[model samples]
Target chain A: MEELLANPYVGPLVLTVAIILVFPLIVGYMVLAERKVLADLQVRLGPMRVGPYGVLQPLADALKLLLKEDIIPARADKWIFWLAPVLSVFTGLTALAVLPLSDRLYVADVNIGILFILAMSSIGALGLILGGWSANSKYSLMGSLRAAAQMVSYEVPLGFATVTAIMCAGTLSMQGVIDSQFERGVWGAFDNYGLMLIPTVLFIIAGTAETNRAPFDLPEAESELVAGFHTEYSGFRWSLFFLAEYAAIVVISALCVTLFFGGWLRPFPNVELLEIPFNTVFPAGLCLLIAFGCLKGVGKQVVPGFRFLMAAIAAAFLGAAGLFVLPLTNELVIGLFWFAFKLGVMVYLFIWYRGTFPRFRYDQLMDVGWKWLIPISMAGLVLNGAVQLLARG
Target chain B: MLIDQVLFYVLAVLILGSAVMTITRRNVVYSAVWLISTLVGVAGIFLLQGAEFLAGVQVIVYIGGIMVLFLFVIMLVPLEEEASQRRFSNQKWLALATGLAVLAMLAVIVVRGIGSLDHPGPAPPPGPASLTQNSEAVGRVLFTEYLLPFELASILLLVAIIGAIVMSKARRRQTES
Candidate 1:
């Protein structure tokens, strides 16, 4: 048992398990962050009553969702309805298996990592369509139809954009793409005197659509479809859909950071002058700053138990921060720290988008995807290919 | 090795069972769902064979794109009308006999082929590294050896797209004139 425990693979296996376990919790807190950020944007206090500026809101929400009665409508296709959310959650979580979080972190190091990701995410679309159809409601059907149309249309541009990056990197492996970027001393977006800029922009726009976030969220537009595909889903089942959506958002943002922002790489990673400070001070300072913010929130908290919980979280962050100050942990945390930092920015962009943009009309959404994004991305891909060819010549 | 054998058998059974279920399902939607499961089973088999890229493409294109299109068409069909249609009342004994004969022929082929397939005389067992390198190796051959076929296939697809647009536009022009 001890020998088995000491095995090198055991460490990564355990960590991967921990990541899977922790994913839902992180997703739950992301909901909290979105609520807080959106509220700030709209000039509201948000869930102020839920333990120190709504810090405990996600936990509360989870408890409520778990306790609430799950309903399957009398007319609903029970098997497919039950299967839909399972499909959603399954695809969402499985895509995480191939994601290279840091150098040492990842569940599997698949050669066709991006292809695997694309496959899983595309399958996720089936969940939404099936859920909507199984509901047997007109609104649900319409919403799902819109979603299916949107996803299928947007995927073209998204593929083109990804292909553009694959061309730049000359490898399909997620880590290889990152390593290529590091070796070239430029992110995929800034390659060839900003030639890849168009595709990067195209990817973000299409990725936003692909995730069904706002501006592209015609499927679930409350004004039209009355909550869209999952309209008939209730309680725990509904929360499964919510969890899947947020997890998918995380997957997309993580991919974005890996592809465009440089996976696990700090600013100017190759620069000898900036390397030492960035490697040490940046991670330590960032973690400490996050810890400080959490600690600051504890002061404004109301309930004693909530405050205590917040304090514990703060301490954990502080401990992580403290680890970074030392040489051993500094090396360990830098990869993760930079990766998380970039991913956090991408996630923030998602919330900021939701707050600012109005939902696109169905036709308009289709027009943008088909007529505009697709052509632009295809042109960008061709142009980049030409540039690379010319440069080589 | 034992686990791999077990998994292969399980997926084989699933593929066959799902194929039967897909055709037998009274509801079109259920049939489509089963068809998807069958496709997924095939993808699983591909994965087991270490054709990981092929597996991904199977899911992406067949299950994702084509299956979605199938579902769309199925959804447009009037369910009430479809539900009332006689499902298995054709009573075509010749059709059933032909199907059985085909199955028998396939069984015979498989039984005959299985003995010869075990030994690829000179080639060693392709391991995990070969599995990971599957796509790159395939791409290399495809671009070099089958370059003509590959380019021709793409040109054909491009022509089809242009033909579709031209046909649509011609109809619109006639309507306007």
Candidate 2:
């Protein structure tokens, strides 16, 4: 019994289960954050009717979606229609199983980790296409077609850009890529005399398109496609699509961090004398600051019940901060801290793009992806390859 | 070991069953989706063999890109008119004869080669486990030993693209004139 309990797989299995249970909640709040941030950007109050600052808005939304009646079109292909959202959610979540959050906190460390992630995400395009076609609505058909076309076009540049980084790192494993970055004392983004940054930028652009975010979200341009492929879907099915989208957003952002930013490695990690303080104090300080802000919100709130929730949230943050500062807990928790921090920053950029950019017309989206991004990324790949050869030689 | 065998049989069954369904389905859209299932099952088989990189490539290139194209074609073709046809058409028997002949020849070669293949060498240096560095090993082989064929393949593709463009351009000019 002890041997079974002490097995190496046991801890990671528990972590995997914890992640599976908690990931949707994190993704749920991501939606809230996006709404709030976009609202702030547009000078509007977002979701204030729920708990404090609409903090409980996602919970309410989930309840409502769960309770709402689901409707399937009478002529729709029943099996494929039902399969689409499940496939979307599955593909999005499967990518999570391979991503390295921190040094020690991924579900599985596959040999071709990055490649596995890319393949799974690309397969997500199939879900969109299938969903649209099976819906028996012209709008759904058009939307899914556009999504498939856009996703495939962007994938080429995305692959080339990833090739550039893999060339720089000389590895394909996600963890190995980060370790190579740390060994070289430079992030992959800033490598190869700043040439790799081209691929990094291309990656970010193609990633935005791949995930069907604004400026590249012609597939679901609400004015044109009426909610796109999911227009015919209702209630829980619709929520599944929404959840899959946000989960995909989280996956893409987390991946960008793992690829370009240093995964779980603090900035300037190679500076040996400063490393300990830099790694230890930074997370502790950030958590404490978050707790302070949450606590500060409690005093400003008007309602007692909402204030109590804020107090609870503030306490949670404080406790997390305490965990980060404590020696044993610090070691256990700090990896998660850095990974989440970088992921949060990447997600912030995603929200920032949504706020700033207008939707790209279909022709322009294809032109940018095919005529511009792919060629530039190819050149970046060649440039990185040459640099790698020369540097080694 | 037991788990691996179980997974292999499961995925192999899935692949073969879906492949049969893919060809036998009357609906083109259904056929394409079944083809996707077959491709995914094949990828699962690769994963079972510990060829992680190969499995990823199979899914990405075949299922993701090519299957989408297949769906596009299926959508374009007017399938309603030809949804149901005579099951055992006259030409099908002739095709079956040719297919069986080819299969029989291949089977004979495989059956004869089995013993020699089993003990061809003392032992190979790398088994599937050491295929952990799958991509690296593949790159090394391609760049060093197979570099000429690889480069030639790219050149062939580029030539085909140019040929296609020239033909299309000539047709457009003729139409305009």
Candidate 3:
């Protein structure tokens, strides 16, 4: 197993499959989760008819989108019109490649992971610009222009916020940042420098703007621009736009997890209890460890079948361990519990933003991005740098 | 070694293709985009060469700042069909000849350079020493060894900014008059 992990091709290949398969699934369900939450908030039931309590709503939506007719406007440039959604979806997915979900999980943990993510995000804006321009509609054109300006403005602060993490962690690798947070003894805003209260708040705000979530979702303000850059798109093509937006939300959320939330890290780093007795006596500890290794291996295969098998196996093991293994694997159980809890909180906040806030006016979006978020994030970066220097001194 | 090969091929294709597209594209906006691709490719080349600070500066200065200015200009320019056509004169033959000559020279230099190289040169020592040493050395040399040239570059940038402002103001006055 160690030998397999040590294999150069095997590690990266597995990471790539895990990223591609898992991220979109998370995004798809997140869409359903948001709908349900919003529906409940507005005193309505959301997709109750779809598989038991709407568990299958996302799948149903996916099938509906797949069967929908793809449309192209009469005046649109056919080539660019086709290319735009592809670009948007491609760039949106590209971010997942650099994001680290766990210590050993990332498609490609580049030395310049943050910069690569930022660059890929800017490419998504290019798709919006092209989509709007090719449509040849006034509303679409205005939406695209506003989106481009908004993204460009917010990107500055987003970059600054990212630089704060990079400076504090002293590494550009997403995994490294998470490891730093874990090594510091806590997760999220509770980590180093006596808690990252200010910086994390700044990062969350900047991240919201960067992903164009509500209160900053000027690009797709339905009341103003009638669906913004995709005003002329319909059916599967329109669904592609929604896919890109939701995927962006997931990517940014994962980034927030990595940068500030100690991604996939259990809450307390010093709490590992070595079970020498269980390993020698019951041997389930060793088997559980082997199961984990297998999950990592199978997860890398990038096939849906393997991924489902891996998840099911993990769940089965946890369920079967109720009698003898529960006492032995308490720390491991707790660790997994904390990890899931953290991810759930982050996911809830993403949906909460969608449900609560109204979309920003285009000018307000630009102003907050340029005037407030950017400066505050820059100040955070400076403060973080100074803190690091002082700590070293 | 595999990463190096991939980076080399990707950067080479990006730089060459985008450079060609920059001139070949008739639309001013497309040309600006091609220019951005060219600049981004150069940044990638810097990364391939293990120059991280240089790569960051390349993106920040060229892509983030300068390209925005270029895009603003392109957007403001009224590139009507007649104006676009008038901008290009009947100098295709001359341009092609010049381009071919430059390409031939570049090919010869590259071929000669490859032929002169030793296979699998000694690997440098790894870790932060190798990574930071070069950048720190360059910084020292830049600040002290080549301070005059560095100062001159800043002065040149200042002059360009002032000249741009003057040109725009003059144009505005002329339009008003």
Highest-scoring model, TM-score? 2
Docking class of 2: acceptable
DockQ category of candidate 3? incorrect
Record all residue pairs in model 3 with backbone atoms less than 3 Å apart, i.e. clashing. A14-A300
TM-score of model 2 relative to the true fold? 0.94
> What order do you get sorting by DockQ, best first?
2, 1, 3
The sequence of per-residue lDDT tens digits that candidate 2 reaches over residues A1-393 is 899867767766787788778887887799899999999999999999899989899899888889999899999999999999988888887888878888878777777888888888877788888898899888998888888888879989999998888878888888888999999989989988888899899989999999999978887889989989888998898887887888788888877887888888888778888756766677777778877888989998999998999989888878877787788888887777778889999899999999999898888888898799988988888888888789878
The C-alpha TM-scores of every prediction are 0.93, 0.94, 0.76
For residues A319-378, write the lDDT of model 1, one tens digit per residue. Answer: 887888888978777888888888999999999999999888777887898899999999
- Tens-place lDDT digits, model 3, residues B1-177: 776788899889999999999978777766767887898899888876777667756766576555654554454455566345755568978988998999999999999889657675656444321223444456679999899999999999999999999999999999999
- Share of native interface contacts recovered by each model: 0.39, 0.46, 0.00
Give the higher-DockQ candidate: 1 or 3: 1
List runs of model 1 lying over 4 Å from the truth.
A5-12, A294-303, B87-115, B118-131, B166-177
TM-score of chain A of 3: 0.80
Q: Which residue window of length 10 is worst by lDDT in model 1 chain A?
A: A7-16
Proportion of the native interface contacts kept in model 2: 0.46
For model 1, how does the per-residue alpha-carbon lDDT over B87-124 read when each residue is reduced to its tens digit?
Answer: 87667788899999999999999999999987755442
Instruction: State residue B30's C-alpha deviation in candidate 2, in Å.
Output: 1.1
Candidate 2 ranges beyond 4 A from true positions: B82-94, B116-131, B171-177
What is the C-alpha local distance difference test score of each model?
Answer: 0.86, 0.85, 0.70
Candidates ranked, most accurate by TM-score first: 2, 1, 3
TM-score of chain A of each: 0.95, 0.96, 0.80
